[model samples]
Target: MHRCLAVPEIFSEILKDILPSDEPRLNGTLTSDACHLSLEGRPVVESSEELYQTLLALACTCKRFLEPSLDALWRTVDSFWPIFVALGISERDLEEMITRHRNPYYPRRNPYHPHLSDLSEAQFKELALRLIIDADYNKAQYYLSRIRIFKLHAIPSALLWAVGELSRKWGSPLLPNVRELHLTPPLTKDYLIFCGRRLVHVSAPLSADSPSLTTHSYPNFDSIYIPADNTKDTNDVVSSFIKNLPPMRVIDAVGCNSMPGTLEVIAAMSSLRSLSIGKFPDLSSSPAFLSPGRLLPCLQELLIGDIDLDLCTQLLYALEDPSALRQLHVGYLSTTGATLQKFMTTVATRCSPICLTRFTVSSNGPRRSADAELPYSSKIQPIAVQPAALQPLLPFVNLEYLNINVFTFNYDDGFVESIALACPNIVTLCLNEHPEYIKSRNLTLRCLYPLAKYCPRLESLNMGGFTFATGPGKIGVDGLSRTWTHDERYDVVPGLSLHFLNSSQVGVIDRCLVDIAAYLMDIFPKIRYVDYHPLYFHIRDVREPGWNDWK
Candidate 1:
C-alpha cells in the first residue's frame, strides 16, 4: 500500500468521494423546498450498487481497507436494507418475515420483492420484535454508529418503534451520530427516540393528526423542513407541530396552506430566523396583533410564493419591524401596474430599509403565446412599470441583490438611473423575467451607463429587453446634454467586477456591431461574457455579419 493509503483518514475521504452524496433523491426530482427526502421503495439506485460492491470487496480483501471502506459505505443510509444486511439477517429470514406477515393496506404486486404492500406497521412490528432476538447487536452498533444522515420517505412505524425499543434496551440511540434526518409522512412520537443529540436538520411530513414529539426530544435541531405536497397539512396543524418543538432557527413550509391562526402562531416563534411559506393567510380577517416588530422579531430571511397582490400586501404589513430581514423572495406574483406599485410601496413601508440585502420577485406572467388568449388574460395587461413603482424601494441603500422578473417592466435608462443612484451597493440587477417574450420598449444600450457608472461593486447584470444604442448619450460622449443630466464627474471609472452581461432576450435590429462593442467596452471594461442571442429578435443566425463583431 502507498504511504497515503496508510493514513486511514485520507483513504477514508478518497473512498467517500466515490460514494453518492448525502440524501440522493429518486429520478433527480426535488421537493418544492429543495429538501432531500429519499424516495420510497427505491433506496440505492442500480448505478451505485457496483460502487458499493467494490467497497464491500475491498473491505473483505484487507484489514487496512476495512475501517475506511465501512466508514465511507455507512456514512449516509437511505433504507433499512443496509442495516438488516449488516446485522447478519439472512435472506431466508427476510423472506420468512415477509411471508409470515401480511397487510391488507398494500397489494402483493411482486412476491419476490417486498413491494409497497409488504411494508406496514404490523410487519415492521414483527421485524422489530424479531430483531430483539436475532439482531447481531455488535455488528449493528458498528455500522449504525457511522450513519450521519438517514433519509427515507417511506418509513414503517414499527421500524422506528423497533429502533426506539432497542435504544431503550441498549442505553443509547441506534443512530447516535446522525445529524440530518429526512422522513416522509405519518411520523409518530416514537420516531423521536432515534433523534440523538447530534441531529441538527429534519425534513419530515406533518399533518394535523400527526403525533407530536416533545420539545426536549432533540433540542439540538435548529432547522425543520416540511414538504409542500401534504394536502392534509394545514397552518394550524403545522403551528401545533412547531409549538412543541425546541426553539428552531429555520422553518420551511413551502406551498403549505395558511389558515386564519397561522400568522399568530408563527409570530409567537421569536427564535425563528428564517421562514418559507406558500401563501399568506388573509390578515384582514385575522385578529389584529401587537406592534409589527413584536412578531417574528428575529426573522432575517423570508420566502413566500404563489401569492396574489392582496395577500402579498397584507403579509408585508404584518412585518412591522423588519430590521433583521436580509433576504426576501416572492414568486408567482399576479399583479398589474397599479397593484405592483402598491405592493412595492407596501414593501418599502413594512420592511427594514437598511437590513434587506437580497430581493427577488418572479411573476406568473404568460409563458406561452396561447396563454395571452385566455379569457382572464385581457383583464390584466402587461403595462410598462413606472419609476414610481420602484421609488418606494429606493430607501434600501444597502441592497446588494435585486432581481425583478416581471413582464411589466421595460427597463430603460430612466429606470436604470433611478436604481443605480438609489442602491449603489447592488451586486446583481436582473430586470427581465421572460427574455424570449420581447415587449415593445424604447430602451437602448445607454441604460447600461448609469449602472456601470454608479454601482461600482456590481458583477452580474441582466437587462434582457434593451436594444443596442445608436442614439445620443452613447458611451464616450463628453456632454451631459440629454434629458437626464449627468454629474460633473465625467472621469468616474467603471467597476471592473462586472463579468456577465445577458442581452439574449432582446429583439433588436441589426446595427453597427463595432459601434456597439466600442460603446460597451468604454464603460464596462471587464465584461467577459455578452449573451446577444436574439431569442425574440429577427436575426436568428449567430454567424450573421453584425453579430460576429460581438464574438
Candidate 2:
C-alpha cells in the first residue's frame, strides 16, 4: 500500500540510525577514505552491523518497501546464527546459543560457545528443516540469493552442510555469485569447494579445509589473504589450494609458515607479485630462516615483521637482485650499534635504488617496559634513528614514501634539510616517537621548512610532534628568529583516526584554536589528509587514501 506520506524521508532516517557514522556516504558524495581494500584510491562499499529489527519493521509495513527493505536486511550475512535465531526456533533449542560467550553476537562469534558441534546430525537437520518449512521467515527467501558476502570464520561445518542440503532440495546453489570468501577453521570439512566465478577476494587462514575441497579450485581467483596464526599445522591443504590457484597477483601469508620453505612454494608460482609476511614472530632469533636469501624474482612488494638489527642486515644481504621490489615494510628494533647505517648503505649500493620508492618500519611492537624501582624509569628503551643513518638512502632520489616510527625527537634542524637533498621526491613521510615517551622540547617547526621548500612533491605527513611551541609565536628559521601570529598551534591531522589527547603538560597540541586553521592549510597546499586526531581536515585530491597503507 502506497498510503504512507514521506516514506522516502522516513526510510532515510531509519537508515541513518542503522549505519555507523557512514550516513553521508551511501549517496556516494563523500570520499571513501575508510575502505581498506582500495587499490588506487577507488571507493569500495563499507559494511557494518545491520539493524535487523528496524529493517524488518519497514518490510512488514507495506508492500512497496518489501524489496528494498529486505535487500538492506539480508544483503550481507557474516554468520548463520542470525538467520536461525530469526527463524523463531523453540526456546529450549535456541537456549543452547546463550552458552556461547558471544552474547547477542551479530557479525562475529559469540563469547560463550554452547558447542554446536555437540549436536547430532539429526538434531541439526531438524532445526534446518524447521527454518526451510517456516513460511513467515522464509517468505523473503529470495534475499538468500541476494547475499553477496558470506564469512564462514568459526562457523560449524555441520550447519554449513545442513544449509547446503536445504539449498539443494530447493534447487539452487547455497551461495550463488558470492563475491568474497573469508575462510577460517572448521568450514564444511566434508563438502567440496562451492563454485562461484563471481568471487574475487578471499581471506584464508592457515588451517585445514574440508576433505572434498582439498584439491578443489574455485573460479576466478585473484587475491588470497592469509591471516596470522602460531599453529604448526601441516600445510597440505594450503599447499594443494595454492598449487591449483590461477595466475594470482597478491598473496598474504601473515602468520602462516613464512619460513623459506613457504616462500619456496610461493616462488614457484610465476604469477605471484606481492607477498606480505607481517607477522613472523620468530624472524629475529633464528638465523636459519635467512639462509634461502632473495628467492622470489618476480616479487614487487614485501612486508616483513619481527626482525631486529642483525637480522635486518642479514636479510638485506640475502635479497638477490631485488630490482622489481618497490614497497618494503620492515619490522625490527633499533640498536646502539651501526646496523641502520649499514643497512641504508647496502640498500643503495647493492640493490637497485631507483625502484625502491616506499620504505616503512612497523610500529607498535611489545611496548617498552617501565622500571618498577624507579618511579620514572623505563624497563626497556628505544634506540632512536640518527640522521647519519639516513645517508645511504639519500642516493635513492626516486624515493616517494618514507615511514620510520622509531626516530628520536632530538633531531636537529639539519636532519630534515639533509632529507630534502637525499630524497627530494618524497611524497608521504611518517616519523613518530612512541606516544608514551615524553614529548621532545626540542621539536620545532624550524625543521619542517626544508620539506616545504625542497620537497615540493611532499603531500601527506604523519608524525607525533613537530612545533611543540604555541603559535603565532617566534620560531627559529634556519637559526634565524621570526615571529608569527596565533594563540596556539597544533600539527595534528584533520582526521578522527588519530589521538589528539596530549598529556596535561602539553606535547605537540596545546591550547589550540580554530583561528590557526587557515595558516596551517597554507603551508601544505597539496596535502590530501592530516590525521591529527579530534581535528580532521580534508583538502585537495580528496580521492587519495588515508595516512597508512603504502599503495
Candidate 3:
C-alpha cells in the first residue's frame, strides 16, 4: 500500500478564459488624443511580446497550482535538456554520453525492439527498478512524464542517442507524453521509432544524410513536414523512413528539390491527399524518373514550383480523369508567354476540368536591362506579358481562388469579363502586376465593373498593378464601388467579408495616398486591413467598431 494525493481541480480552470479562443474575443482599440493618431486619426502603438507570457504570469498566482503550472510549463519544450536537467541528470552524465558515442567503434545496434513500447510491461519494469531510488530521481521522472510536445533545435546528436539508450535500459519512454515532435536536424530515426505511436505529429528538416533505418514503423503519424535539406543521399533517406510508415494524410515537401524521386514515391501511396514539392521533375535531364503507373487519384493539393512547358507536356500529356486535384500552385524557373499558353491548353485537353477550386502561378519576371526605369525600386517597368493564345477556362466552374500576379502579361480588357464569366464561384481574383504602360496597352477601372456585376460571391480582388496612375485617371468612391452594394454593405466581397488583398505589400496609390486608408474601407466596406507599400496603415479608427467613441 502507498500514499496517494490528487487535486479536485487544477489551474486549467483558471486558464480557460485567457487562452486563445473564439468566444470572448479581444477587441481593437484607439486613443482619444489627436496627437496619438498617425494615419486618418487612429492610435498606433509600437510593441510586441510573446503570447505565452500572460499564461505563465497568471499561473504564478496560486500556490496550489504549483504542480499543475509545472505540468503546463513543461508541456511544450523546445530542447530535451530542460526536461533532462529538471530530472536531475548531472553534467557528468552528459559528458559520458558524448564520450561514449565519439568512440567511433561504439556498437550502435538497438537492443530492445519496437514491441517493447507496450505501456504495461515497460512501466512495471521501470517501477521495480526504481523502488528504492532517491527523491530527486522521483522528481526528475515525474516532470519527464509530463511533456506533451518536444521541438529539438540543433541539439547534440550524442544526447539523443543517450536518451534513447537510457530510456530503453529503464523500460520507459524518454518522453512518455510527446504528441508532436519537431526536429531541426534529426541525426537518427532511433529516437522516433523508440516513441512508437505516442508521436502523432512530426516535422523535421530531413535529408539523405540522417542515419537511415531499413525496418521501422510509425503507425500514428498522420501529418509530416519535411523541409528541404541539401544533402547528397536523397534516395536512401526517403526510402528508409517513408516506405515503412502507415498511410499518411498530409505531407509537405516544399523546397525539397534535391530529394529526387521522393515526390513520386509519396504520390503512389494510397492515403496521400496533400503534397507540396519545390519543383516539378525536370524531364529534360531525368525523364526516366517519371511516374509510369496510375496517377495520384487521392491527391487534392499539389503546390509545385519551377515548372516550364517541357515538364507540363511530360506530366499531363497522357494523364486522364485527374479530377481529384482541387488546389494547385505552380511556379516557374523561367517561362515564356507561349509556354504558359501551351501548358494551359494541355491542362484543358488532357485533365479533368471539374475538380479545381484554387489555382496560383508564380513567376520569375523577365530579365530587364539596366535602362529599365519605373517607380518600382529596381527601375524595371513591368510589361504586360499575357499569353499569346486564349481558351475558355469556363469548365473550372468550382474555382474559387485565382492568382497570376508574378507572371507578367498584357491581354485585352475583355479578359476580366471572360474570367468572371468562366469562374462564377471565384471568391478571390488576383490579376498580373505590370508597371504603367502607354494608353494603347492600358486597361481601366470601368472594365472591371462586369467582374463585380457577374461574380456576386467574389470576396477579394487584386487588379494586380492597376494603380490609380495605371488605370483610367483618378477614379475614386463611385468608380471603385462599381455599383457593388449588397445587404447595405459593399458588394465587392462575398457576404461583406474580405481577408487578404495581395499576399503582403499593396499596389501603388498615385492620387491622394493619404485618404487611401479611409477610401479602401468605404469602397470595399468589409476590408479590415490593407498591406500597402511606402505606407503602412493600422486603420484602427475605421476598423474597430467603437474605438473612435472610446476617447
Strongest candidate by TM-score: 1
Q: How do the predictions measure up, each by TM-score?
A: 0.61, 0.58, 0.60
* Model 1 poorest ten-residue lDDT run: 27-36
- The TM-score ranking, best first, is 1, 3, 2
| Distance from true location, Cα of 114 in model 1, Å | 14
Task: Give the CA lDDT, 0 to 100, for residue 22 in model 3.
Answer: 19
Q: What is the C-alpha RMSD of each candidate to the true structure, in Å?
A: 9.8, 11.3, 13.3
| lDDT of each residue in 318-408, candidate 1, tens digit only | 6655666788877654577877788888788777888898887667422211112112233334556766678888889999888776755
* Backbone clashes in model 2: 20
Q: What's each prediction's clash count?
A: 0, 20, 7
Location of the lowest summed lDDT over 10 successive residues in candidate 3: 25-34
Give the winner by lDDT: 1 or 3. 1
Candidate 1 vs 2: which has more lDDT: 1
lDDT by residue for model 3 (36-83), tens: 112111222122133345434545766665555555555556655464
Q: lDDT tens digits, residues 493-537, model 2?
A: 322121223354343243443323333444444344344432344
